[model samples]
Target: MWIEGAKQAGVEAHPWDNLAEEPLPTSVEIEGTTVPVKWLPKPELGESGGDLRNVVFVYESAEPHLRLRWQWQARGDFGPVEHRITIENLGGQEVWLLMVDSLRLDWKVTPTQNLRNVYVEKGADSPSAEGTHLETVSDGYNWKGKSSTYAHPVKDEKREIIPAEIVCDSNGNGWYAGVEFSGRTRISLERNGTSLKSVLGLDPEPGPFKTRLGPGETFETPTVFLGAFRGGPDGAGNQLRPWVRAVLGNPVTWKDPQYPLMVNNSWGSGMQVDEPLALKMIGESKELGLEMFHVDAGWFRGVGDWYSEPKKFPHGLAFIADAAHREGLRFGIWTDWTQAALDTESGALNVRDPKVSDWLVTDLKPDWKPEDFKGQTIDIGVPEAHDWAAKEVKRIVEDYHLDMLEHDGYLVAQGCVQTDHPHGPPNRSTMRVIHDWASDFVLASNSTDVSYHAVRAYYDIYEKTRREHPGLLFEICNDGSRMVDFGSAAHGDYFSITDTYDPLSNRRAFYDTSHLLPAAMLESYVEKWPVPKPENFLYMLRSGMMGWITIMTDTTAWTPEQHEAARKAFELYKAQLRPFIRDAQMFHISARPDGVHWDGLEYWDATRGKGVVYAFRGSIPDEAGHHFILAGLQANKHYRLHFEDGSQPDHEVSGSELLGQGLSVRLWNPLSSELVFLDEVAARK
Candidate 1:
């Protein structure tokens, strides 16, 4: 079917005989044999919801006692369409299934169309040197990008991505697709002469990925979304961000005006935080107009114990929660809920426990000891462990009086050495495990299955948790930004976009991730960074303030001037920036921030006829000015510019001038910044 537009980026029409060999898109392996399916033209129709419609095509293989179904969904009135494959074992015998891809497409583009592939990487652990990538898809081009909860690239190799890609011509009029599963997933694009081929689904490598489908059981591939768009990468993102919010995002969260809150977290002192410090931060948070007081790592009794640290919080977490509430601030705490440690408390997940021993992905060394905030990962895919974790999550939220819960570290298993677990064990001889980045990455025959099961269980737990506590926000920090993808976007309230919290890192991470996600869902932690001047301090704060802001420092220690500056910044964010952040068209008006050049982001609300430009002057000497070409404006209209920092004189300019000549921002100081707010002259009807 055509994409209802010009024939630029989509599945172009081709002869039916061209796809004769692979007419049916679903395939599977049974008992170590690749079995091709024969699909019949019997179509079944159904309505899913007010906005979702589904079409199912039943296909069958020669193998008996098996049922295969391919389902395609049309969601919303706009944006991408979704598709997935499912196979069910109908008889009493168990069937082994393998290698099912969610979606695949072949597009016949014009020869030498000058296509370019645009994609972004996960800020896994920290933002890599090249967070956003655009490369040519010349003839004979072959490319692949993988994604999981986290990534640890080799010394020189392709890194993990945010699990999406856009391939368009110079005009950015092309198709984009992404996987919706947070487990080990992969996307591939290949160009050979006039043909463009791609695939999206669970990574079927790490080879011949296998899963067990028992009697009356079914296995489904991860769902994938595909769409065509114009206006290059930014154009594609503008459509994607809203579609994600309207479809995948939590409806309850969006109903509240204050969905994306401003928070203060106590990680500035590291593991040294206690009752006095938390209370102090709470008061500071209330004074500074921050909404939530989030207690990071140090507040937990131990990694897996999840209770309050008694000596540190003598009155318990509930007492601290009460203190924050009394000061009119919400409370949240961080927990590596699935990691097991050596804590010997009664209810602790001690690795030495007989029952707990079987739950871990791999047996721990006899003398193995967990790091300050790190521990051995448990396989939440295992049913017993899944139940335990789901209960533990509910308990933590209820007992701790949490308005939000942040799950950090390794929360699920992608690899395991246990033979009896649900996903079974990796092949011993071919299995390879890398112990780096304080986490274990397994690569083997069964690794994909391990992640598949674990991801499903993790989703179920969170889905239940959301139902139980309707407004409780979930922060998915699988080692901080490692899990930034559509899957996590649907499951969690926001993502901690990166571990590095400096101004450059925060802006760079946000710039890369916000391409395909709602700005409110891409969170950045405002950690303690070198701030020689109060202007620089606001610059650091506003770096993360573009999206979700979490102050991760000792606010009580700020100088009086800095405190007032921060207070004013917070007030400005709430009144002026928050609305655009939640609902606006964002454009990366400058190239990626290099720390040595001027960088800026434009958030324009065409409907509201107002927006703001977040401009930052980098560390370059004598180069303190830059012109940011604004976007999404009517060229014939006139606009009024208000410089909050008076970097330049407030003036009126025609939209053609602003969009063409650009918004000029000049900061005298090297590390200073400015917020240039703009509105159409015709704003008032």
Candidate 2:
């Protein structure tokens, strides 16, 4: 009967099938002996968030005397299941544990004459590297791998890309799984003839290679997420999106009334921004209805120097912050807190410096000489150094009265190897400490008891900073989305998708990132490229409307007529796209850009009975326009449709006809675009 039940729940056939009656195998090595653990017969179930169910299962092995309390939570009938594992030593003896698997599940398969198709989709850690790739697996093979490890800043340039999430679609059904950890994680999928098995766990090596847990000592694994969908790969991928967002616990939402349309000074002036140019940009930004004004880079003394440049801001950064605040706009500045400049006044020591050898991790290979360190990176794993960073952050926040801090150069310490710090020895494990610090700094938490001391110290800094400045926001920019992950999303409010201004690349990024993140959390900036012609410039603006819109250009170079037109485009975006971006479900009509052709996306709010579709044309002269079947609407409802450009007359049509027939969009010229708005009107009698 238990075997039959397991089969119904997607369990595959295996030699240990009879063990279906037992809980998933969880073991611990104690005193040189491996001990098998058994789960308590009944799970403790309770209610959470009114509709969610929480199940707690305690697994233990009396011989080794350890307990692992597993907490499985289901948000609703359709939501994914999230679980976390916590292991505690119950006996009065020390236990040398080697591994901990947070989750293990078997997927059932039906026998067929031909090999079944299993499709997998994976994502990378960086924004420039963010996109889904499809892979097919057949019988008699196993796909095993660990997540990415950036041994050097440019390692990704040479390494084969790995997926952040491993989703599989087989037999008309889909299954999705991803680790919520920002650190190293392990994932595996195996198919043998008729059975499939999937597993997720932390990468335990180097330091935790042998965790000696004394009596009462506890260790917790990062949360793992798993879900199954009846739809295909797209459905499976979409199902994980909301689940990931929920797990991150980010407070900022699309519905936030105060969300800003930010204007950045990077594209126009470069990194050499001065107070006069900043003040001029602020004045123009206000006239253009920009809610936030940010000075990107160049304001500080150098990379690690958080203080304002005395020459650029003779009166100090507080003056600029106050001026923006008085103009009713939020102020922000950019800085890279992760690394110090080689020529800065601090004379900070980089991780590869021989003088800081005692303060670095041990992962620095013996063969690699100190001269190989190419950039400045301070090892924040040291208590004194970590504290100093925290104080510096607080000083800037209070001294400038800043509302947002855009952090760049996060990968500066990707290769640090000093292991003499308090956390643990210098090894690959030390990288996890740095990653956790970056995560904690962006996401402020009230929890006092984090599992790791290094992580807790960073969290404490953010927590206190938040208390002092309640409305502060953190934007994570790691040399163009290198650090984008669930952990960063949890801590930071928004992410700059890419720093490049190429329209085609930016368009592809928009389509790809919108799949994994909400439109509000993804900010796309319009570059000052292609000479900013009216037609192409408007196309760039519309392309970025799917996410938060950022205009990066020089107002001083614009003519009076150009300024008027730019202001009108910004107004139209604020009126027509902002609500849809905030509340509607995004549908990627074209996930990739086809050279010199049409690529687009749609945003629809079914509950509100309204939506918008954005269509674009490439640079090919012969390519005129494209037709896309609009999605996410009530088929039977009558709707009013019109183009934002006013080239087409407003007309009435039923949603069914529109969905069945399709919406045809024609641009006025090559490399142009159009915006179509749909609203449900009175039903035809």
Instruction: List the lowest-lDDT window of 10 residues for candidate 1.
Output: 13-22
Q: How far is 57's C-alpha from truth in model 1 (Å)?
A: 1.5
lDDT of 1 by residue, 1-685 (tens): 2243112223333221112122453545556676654544434422233323555667555454666777667565567777777877776766677677787777777785889998998887668788899999998889999998666655467778999998888765877899898989999999887688888889988766888887888888998887777788998898889889988899998886886899999998899889999988988999999999999998877767888888999999999999999998899999988888888987799888988989887777787788888888888988999999999899999999989999988787788888998775588999887775345567778888998899999999999999999999999887778777888788999999888889899999999999989999988998888899878998898899999999988887789999999999999999989999999999999998888889999999999999999999999889977889999998999999999988778899899998899988888888779999998997446
The true-versus-predicted C-alpha distance at residue 424 of model 2, in Å, is 4.8
Model 2 lDDT tens row, 429-487: 23343333222121111001111333334445666766677678777666555545554
State which candidate has the highest lDDT.
1
The clash numbers for all candidates, in the given order, read 2, 11
What lDDT is reached at residue 177 by model 1?
A: 92
Taken over the whole model, the C-alpha lDDT of each candidate is: 0.83, 0.59
TM-score of each predicted structure versus truth: 0.95, 0.80
Off by over 4 Å in 1: 1-52, 61-63, 437-439, 683-685
